[model samples]
Target chain A: MTQQPTAAMLAIGDELLSGRTKDKNIGYLADAMTLAAIELKEVRIVADDQEAIVEAVNALRARYTYVFTSGGIGGTHDDITADSVSAAFGLPCIYNDEAIKRLAENYARRGIEFNESRRRMARMPEGAALIDNPVSTAPGFVIGNVHVMAGVPQVFQAMLANVIPTLQGGVAIISEAIDCPFGEGDIGTELAAIQKAHPHTSIGSYPRFSDKGFNTQLVVRARERALVDAAAIDIRAMIAALQG
Target chain B: MTQQPTAAMLAIGDELLSGRTKDKNIGYLADAMTLAAIELKEVRIVADDQEAIVEAVNALRARYTYVFTSGGIGGTHDDITADSVSAAFGLPCIYNDEAIKRLAENYARRGIEFNESRRRMARMPEGAALIDNPVSTAPGFVIGNVHVMAGVPQVFQAMLANVIPTLQGGVAIISEAIDCPFGEGDIGTELAAIQKAHPHTSIGSYPRFSDKGFNTQLVVRARERALVDAAAIDIRAMIAALQG
Candidate 1:
């Protein structure tokens, strides 16, 4: 809370690596981190291997203020992220009583038995805190700087949103978008010039698939809304003049 | 083709690192590489800085069989990916003749003027072969093992699909999924046993957001469908018994 928090996201899944599923957790976390004024520094997607998860978690935890990981927290064989992270921190994995009760009660509401495998969801590293999962009761856990959560995009997102608000924020996000007909090269040099003119703003250009045609969406974001809007207006005028 | 085809994905943009964009490119490329039988060992997401792109491309090109980059190939100021790749390869980035012709023709059909900024899309490293873009006219290019493409998920995906058929494939994808009611801990020991039982199958468990309650989806993947299926059957039976 003293210094601005910077975070890293590690997405663990072989399915993601094999392209069986599009991992949307990273984007969801990124947006949430930005909104909380926490800087999202790096994201790594590694296969669900203990060594890989351990290595990534260690590296990110050392470099960034916090590490937010999604996936590999399940009861199945490959869900080794929590164990690996616990190992990295030299912490013992233990069953969290609070998490177990919460998950069991959630299942009881649906008249479903909280089986042994389901009970495994309650395990957390010693000295860890449980992250609330209102959408699903299998609570994400925080150990040291690493927060381990479900890989399911929706659930992971919900958990992250719930957690991020409790963290301290430094800046609010303000951005403006300009739909430009100009292709990249024609406006490349001038755009570069404009960026040099405004050192504080973060300029982004996203090429969108539009019905009208391939259009470039140029966005300028900053802590200040007026600066963002001004930059966008100027950029839009520059694109129009280039077309003329 | 002569060597074990290797590929790496370079995701460029501040949005990604800032947590404004959770990247979909790495997962897409990983799957595409696996299907192509190409070894995808590493993927790095960097800010849209020319130096960072050049350094990453150079480092990856030396170590990898292929380096495919996404983002920064647009008309805006942050669209410096093409230039950086050119710098890394020590190739002159010129307004590609064929690309210009295509852009001009494509723009004419859409009744839009081909402005100078738009012409930036035509710039490519000297001697690079253009990768087909079915969804958009802004074609990606391949210089040696480096394939530079768009950042937008849909466009990047379409370009990947187009490029994959031109490459060789490794083992065909074969997989099976098992639903587990048990929590991760109770099945952790048994899941390890199942993995040991079938060393060839890539067994993984994903926690899904479920209406009934939190459930784990266990998947086994291999070159042989029957082998994968057999592993999944064992995994399911084990999970069921363990939960009971």
Candidate 2:
């Protein structure tokens, strides 16, 4: 069996840290990465400070197979992701001719002025590949393993679509869930044993309380479908025995 | 002005990393910390791995004034927060008699068995203080500067209420927002000047696209209300001038 590709996400913006903006990008990227057979192992949210961005980018890019950063790449003063990313890799960030042409054409077609701030969006790290943005003309860029994307959900999603197809994928993880009408305590010992038996699979017990009273959802996940199914069956039988 | 008390948050759960659960705890804690005159500096989301939890807890606790961790404090096999936190601090994790009594009473009152898994919630690092969980019977614990709370939204919020009042707060940050019907490029230069003028304040420009065309929300935040208002006035004037 091949090893699964691991990824980390960095959500950059003062808006997120200050609670002014609730981040939607992390969950979106998490699901997308999973579907692409890339395991998203860690996620970090940092403010718009350049030092913070550089530090997080360097750390995550080194630790994971891919590091995706969202936000701080727009046409504003706080949009420093491109520059910070360049700093992390010791690369020079300059305005790319292709990005400039794309932005200028989009602005000209809309009859909007291609002002300095708008032109700032054309800047990319040296030797970086541009990630296409279908929603907006401003392009995201990939430097080394770090993919810098816009903070806007529409643009980020679009850019992700462009990037995911270019990467190598591993075996997709299969998951099975069983809703057990019992507290975690009633099924934990048995659940642990099942987990022990299926060492390759991951068994998670999530407890929820609603009008129906306490309930637990046991999720079994593994790269192999047979392992997931086997573990799930054992979990179901254990829950049934505990209920009785 | 007094240095603002800074905090970091660690959201622990495989459900979150797997995108099975969209995290609501980070935003809630961000807003709560802001209101309490604390600045939330960073947020990390990690899976149900003990090593990940320990590393993040230790790193965040060392960097920020306070480290708040949510999730993994429940009665399940994946609930390894207490053990991980103890390991981070190099403290012995043991069952607290007080916590055990509380759980036993809550379970007995509800006619539920205090099984071994449920009893697991009573374990805490030696010399840690218990944080009240108003919504659930399982209590959270605080060891040193790290405050560990439940992963469930209701229990996490309830524990936050119990924890916030006990902390020392700094100068409250005041924020003002202005909605301008212009693209970020139209106002970026003037916004930069305004930000420079108010060195103590933080000005963030967020762009949006809707049927009404491009728009930007300029948020000005500072420890002093006068500085925030001043920055907002300059930003509003710049937008009005640009529109003219």
Candidate 3:
């Protein structure tokens, strides 16, 4: 039997840590992965330090089928993602001849000087393939199972859009929700029982306070369409019988 | 000398791991902590499993000055954060009389049935103090340094707003950046020199592709305004001399 494709996301930036920036990348990529049927199993947010990036990449890559890393790929002093990824795999950092050629061409068209620092973007881990960045010329790359993308949301999303299409996917997961006016304790035991009976289905309850009263949101999820529907049916019935 | 207040973020949800949801809570809380002058040192995201939450809470709380958790505190079957935190410290889950009273009264105004499931939101750890949730009636709570908050962004933000103003903060960290038109290797040595010169400041070198070609973005960060400004100036001057 073929194993399900699993992914891990590593978000790197000190700005994220200091709360200077809100990371929108994780959710965007997560939704993208879900749409593509790639299961995102884990996410880690690490500082933009070389040691941390290297360690995280090495660890996550070995554990998951695919690893998607965002941030720290820019031309900033805080951007050390590429070098760290290379070091993590003991690969040499070298300029991708094709990337450099394209970058130089793009710069020429834009009438921008392909300065030394700007030219540095073409450098990537040896043997890695470039993931195109349409929003900007800075190309994201794939080294082994790790896909290193840009940090800026626009460029990152563009790169990811290009990268995800190339990968294989599994059955797309779907979800549904039912609002229950009852408290969680009234149904916690039964819900746990339902979960145990249907191990494949993912069930969750979210409680919110509305002007009418505090309401509980029971969410059901599954990779199989039938199972999700069945779970929702059972869940709605349980809530109705117990509360209504 | 006074030690800085530190905080860690704990995001609890299977939705996060499933990639169905992107976490805004951590980034939001991190920003709030920074604004309050607290140092956010670490963040951990665990699935909505009891053991996972308990283990994470126990481990993180001991290391950081405070642990703020979001998600899984709702009134759903998946909402086990309160119990998990309580279990971690061997505390019992009990309905807060005050919470139950308030919840009942609040629901009465709306003419909604205060079902048993909804009452679960009123459950608190034996000694937990409720953190006011202005956006919603289901209050967040604080036990020692661990603050349990709602997962919904608006509610979470409001809940955090209620808590942040009361916490102690330290000097706000600041940053500055300069673009260098050089490859990472070309300036690696000089960059090392800068890092050594400003040990208190964090210097990051990111290599990226720009319209001008590959450029490096060098960022210097420090808590002291004067030091950060000085480092930025020196960094720019060094890059200038390197390019020249």
Candidate 4:
């Protein structure tokens, strides 16, 4: 069987690192990529430094099938993701005519002046394709495998919606969760044995402790439903044996 | 004044990457680190793969003053963080007597069997010191510059409380927020000029759009209060000019 298309995310901003902002994009992108059958391999959140952004972009782009970046695409001085991405790809960051025209029209309709700073949104790496942004007219861009989108949660999500459908995806990974009455310490041994027995499927045990109670949840995941089911059965039996 | 101690975070687990769990630790840690006067430079989330964990651990540990890791420290099969940390440091992973006895007593008091799988939590790189986990008895460990903590938010926060005081920190970064009536597009030009003028500080303008309304929040951050205040004064004057 062929490997699924893999993705990595670069969240660029000082606001996120300074704890002034909580990240809404990583979880959103992870959930979206999982549903699209594109495996999200890694995610890196870096400050709005061009060197750091360029380094992370180059590293992840070389490894993953696709690299999606969120944040740093606005009109302000800190919005340097587009230029950094261009540097990563060794291309000149340019103000594309199509993007500039679209953005100009959008601003003109709203009676907002399309000033030089506002026009900065139209800058993209040379030979890049635009990703549609329905929420706002400032389009995200795709250069090579890197997709640079907006930092705002709504805009990032909207641009991602337009990007996911275009990517090639493989079989969806299925997951089954069985809640064990006992804790992870109680079932960790047999669970390891079961996971070793079914090498193809991946098993993860999560212990939940809340005001309600404490219980262990065993998650089984695989591309094929049969493999996931097979591992899940052993997990249930392991819990049952502990009860017996 | 000397630079603040820099830190990087590695969030490890398949559950996080698969979107089975939305991470609460990164934001919490970022907030805590910022308050402690330690700069959190970068954060990476990787699956529970040993090679990935080892590589990230080494890379971050090499660059930053401290490397804090969350997740993959439980008793289950997927908990490979302890072993990976040992590999990264080229040390032997062993069950420390102090950690083992502490965990054993905690389980014994709770009338739970301290099985081999439970004892697995005591495994840490050689010459590592234990970080206290008051909520759960399975103590996290600190080896060299890396501090390994639990994945659960409650326990991770608890463990971090114990670890933070031991580290050295510098001057706190002061941030001042000025709420602008206009949007980012309206102020991006003058904002850029202000940011360029105050090259020593970082100025970020975030657009807020909700049922309440649309506004831009301009944040100024610097190690010294005067730099931040001066920048804020410039930012406010610029906004006033825009209104005029």
Residue-wise C-alpha lDDT for candidate 2, range B139-242, written one tens digit per residue: 89989999999887766776776687687778555667688888766777888898899887767655543446556566676777898888888887887788
Residue A49 accuracy (lDDT) in model 3? 85
> Against the native chain B, what TM-score does each candidate's chain B reach?
0.68, 0.70, 0.70, 0.70
* Model 1: how far residue B14 lies from native, Å: 3.1
Please tell me the TM-score of chain B in candidate 1 relative to the true structure's chain B: 0.68
Per residue, candidate 2 scores C-alpha lDDT tens digits across A1-244 of: 5778999999999889888899999999999988998999999999988899899999999999999999988888878888899999999999989999999999999999999999999998999988999898899999889998999998999999999999888889899888899877777777878889999998898888653445788888998889988888888788778767
Output the better candidate (1/2) by DockQ.
Answer: 2
Error of 4 at B96 (Å): 0.9
The best-first sequence of candidates by DockQ reads 4, 2, 1, 3
**What is candidate 2's CA lDDT for residue A13?**
91
User: Which of the numbered candidates is closest to the native, going by highest DockQ?
Assistant: 4
lDDT of 4 at B179: 80
Per-residue lDDT tens digits for candidate 1, residues B1-244, read 3567666677888878766556777876776576556777666677787886898789778977777889877766667888999999899999999988988987787676787777888888999888876556778998888888889886687566556656554555566657787645567788888889997776655443233544555656677878787888888688667757
The window of 10 residues in a row where model 3 chain B has the poorest summed lDDT is B205-214
Q: Once model 2 is optimally superposed onto the true structure by TM-score, how far is the C-alpha of residue B127 displaced, in angstroms?
A: 0.6
Candidate 3: segments with Cα more than 4 A from true spot: A179-197, A208-213, A238-244, B19-22, B51-59, B86-119, B122-129, B134-139, B171-244
TM-score of each: 0.71, 0.85, 0.73, 0.85
For residue B40, model 4's alpha carbon misses the true position, in angstroms, by 0.7
The TM-score between candidate 4 and the true structure equals: 0.85
User: Please, what are the lDDT tens digits per residue for candidate 4 over residues B150-170?
Assistant: 998867876776687687867
How does residue B231 of candidate 3 score in lDDT? 83
